[model samples]
Target: MHHSLFLMGAPGGGGNSSVLLIYLGLMFVVFYFFMIRPQSQKAKKQKAFMSNLQKGDKVVTIAGIHGTIYKINDDNATMQLEVSPGSYLKIEKSALSMEWTMAQQKAAEPTK
Candidate 1:
């Protein structure tokens, strides 16, 4: 039957299965490199950014609120953001928007 398949211009079963396995393996590797790896790295970077936050550093929240860090409550993972002088809001640490805050910082930088 295998020889007959070759004569009929069809792939043999044994070779096809190995090729299918190779394709499936390549797909998983592609997904890991293109999808999984970058996502994990970004999460790590975000975590580090959140951990290093300090008082007086400006930040934007996921809800689009822009403010400066007034105080951090490490015990409860929350912070007080000063949107304006004497005006503060307490929000969760996870609510900070790393991307937006970085973009705002870049935009505020003085270019040579």
Candidate 2:
């Protein structure tokens, strides 16, 4: 007589399922903001930097070669990296490092 069966109409049974779904949704939102959103924004910035490559701008390649942009062959997606005066190495625009270039620029600025 002490034993009872939990039926489909149990008071708390349905409540937990909705709570679990809400918790999962909240976790996805958190990950989207913290991880996915920043990654996408960074990719956009990198793409813009790649597209805006110009002659006479200094850049460092991802492979650690630093040089001034001698010529941009947008027709072929490559650039001539002049590591020294009249000396050049042709490489892809994608090989440039945006973060390194920004750091070098920051270091070159005079502090008041």
Candidate 3:
């Protein structure tokens, strides 16, 4: 009877389980901070850049095509881009990426 009682009264193996749960929770927090937050921030910045596009702004498309904006049809979700003199292409607004902020800065620099 005392042997059975001793076995029943022994502490259950819950300490390891609780430690595992704590470890998993910490891993999730680390992943969110390192992997998820920066990506969301980049997406938000890209969305803002796309929304602020205007006519006559130079932009580079996602396919690496560079052009100047000839027209903006925000209602129709399209824009006309002049890739070269006397050459033009109609592309969706989403196709444009990475506005030429650095290019503009370079142009504004005084030539040596």
Give the TM-score of each candidate: 0.87, 0.84, 0.74
Highest lDDT: which candidate?
Answer: 1
Per model, state how many residue pairs clash: 0, 0, 0
Worst 10 residues of 2 by lDDT: 1-10
lDDT of 1 by residue, 1-112 (tens): 7755643443445566666677799999999999999999999999999889999998999999999999998675999999999999999999999999999999989998
Give the alpha-carbon lDDT of every model: 0.90, 0.85, 0.78
Residue-level error in angstroms, candidate 1, position 68? 0.2
Tens-place lDDT per residue, model 2, 1-112, is 2223223234657855666677799999999999999999999999998878799988998988889999988575898889999899989888889999988778878998
> Which should have the higher lDDT, number 2 or number 3?
2
- How many backbone clashes can be found in candidate 3? 0
Task: Give candidate 3 regions above 4 Å deviation.
Answer: 1-12, 74-76, 99-112
- What does candidate 1 score in Cα RMSD to the true structure? 4.2
RMSD of 2: 5.4
> Predicted candidate 3: what Cα RMSD to the true structure?
7.7
RMSD for each model, in Å, please?
Answer: 4.2, 5.4, 7.7
Query: In candidate 1, which residue ranges exceed 4 Å CA deviation?
Result: 1-11
| Cα-based lDDT at residue 25, candidate 1 | 100
